[model samples]
Target: MRVNAKSQKPKTPKGFIGPIGFDLPSIMPIVFAIIVFFSAVSYSYTTVNEKNNVLDSIESSIKIADILKGNSYLFFDATDSGAKNKFASNCEKAVNIAQSKNINFAATFVKLDSSSSIEWLIENKESEIDSCTTADGKHLCWCGFSPKKFDSNLSKQFWSISFPVTVDVKPPGSGPEDIYPQSYLRKIIVVVWK
Candidate 1:
């Protein structure tokens, strides 16, 4: 018996004709995958950038607090409760320091377990809000510029920190026993904003 063989043409879908016609379907998955990958990458980049900004603000606030605490002019004597004649000058220096670092600074000396509070600010419009005052009308022995914002804009990144500090309070003197100074623990609140 003689063998006979015939080859048949591959079938093509209707209207599918051209050299690149079949390539579109094959390339679609690749194109879709690229779009998905890029979208994910872009989203991750934005999230990371936002987080970094927040972290930088937090770090700068901490640094400002440390600088204020270490400033000899501002906290001249941890034992001396009374402000020196140059105390205002020292606070201005602190504000200048914070401004140099591109941030705003504010400090509140709050007496523990008492309504007495002292605000250290630059005495500007923004600082006029009386952040240290309580709803019960906090008593202020001294309310003046100490720490301050570098800019007039109040809307910005802000952080606050409070720590304990010892201060010597001079009692009213009339007799020999009034000469001794009383020590009190005060809370120093440091606020930093950019």
Candidate 2:
């Protein structure tokens, strides 16, 4: 028996189209799935990034509070009023260092009176020391950046911590018999942002 070559070869059906590789219906689902997957991944990444920023801000704030309380650069021997130059220099340096690390820092000293009123000594500048009176009508000085400087419109994470600190304050123009400076307990608030 003779085999016909044309009969053995494959033949296209009548009205048959070209290859189905470019078919829209089959490609639509794949495109949709890919879009969904990428969207989910982007959202997850953004959420994680925001959470990390917040955690970093909190950690920095805590560390800054510890430094402010423990370090002698800002205040030596708990004497905030006597070390103005040293405080200013250290304050500027600390701020610059924090800024270099993409973090913002500020600290202030406050005293609460018996009448539930707050006395604030906000830091205005490195050279300018803001003074506030404690409950006992004693002056207290501090070196820190003001919280007002932080813009409300900026989308940044912020963290703050406040701790009690005992500071030595000298009465203005004390007599010869006044050899010891009065001790005042105050709060030091440290704020960090990114």
Candidate 3:
């Protein structure tokens, strides 16, 4: 049952050849609708990706801060020079973990200070917006704000609300005593972004 190729024409895919080829007004609305649909999908995809990235950063930062709580020195003896040094080292560890996970974050130890050098909170300002001008007189300051952002554009989108978390560890009796000599409530605020 051999057939001659020249006798039969090649078949075209189903939608390629309409009865009326390229009808302008009739097809315009359909083309416009397809374009609009694709554009909307593309926009939604990018938006979702950006939001997911931001959330990833926040989660990574929180994890880093939580890791610090497991260690006692940062919270218990914040005023002690040794404890302060340990806290700084822990912050570095957080940064390293962020780098490995491709997240940008700044974690800090914040404590309340009655004598902060920052202008006293405005009368109408939220109570959480207090200053820490002399906290420990050393490693940390500015109350609960995040460190300055490395990129200006990124900074615009930073999630920077400070909240206090529990630090159950007690200050070591052997830590520097004259430097406050007692434990104060503290917060480990972690601001993360992609």
**After superposition, which runs of candidate 2 have C-alpha atoms over 4 Å from their true positions?**
1-22, 71-93, 112-140, 147-151, 175-180
Highest TM-score model number: 2
Provide C-alpha RMSD values for all models, in order.
10.6, 8.3, 10.5
TM-score of each predicted structure versus truth: 0.49, 0.60, 0.54
Most accurate candidate by lDDT? 2
lDDT of 2 by residue, 1-194 (tens): 99999999789787557677458678899899999999999999999999888888887777667666655223322223335424345555566667766787767665533222122233342211233333444233443445564455542455767777765543445454654355556676666766
Q: What shift in Å separates residue 15 of candidate 1 from its native position after superposition? A: 4.9
Candidate 1, superposed: residue stretches over 4 Å from native = 1-21, 71-90, 111-157, 168-183
lDDT of 1 by residue, 8-51 (tens): 56566698877788898988998999999999999999999978
Q: Assess candidate 2 and give its TM-score to the true structure.
A: 0.60
Winner on TM-score between 2 and 3 is 2
What ranking of all candidate models by lDDT puts the best one first?
2, 3, 1
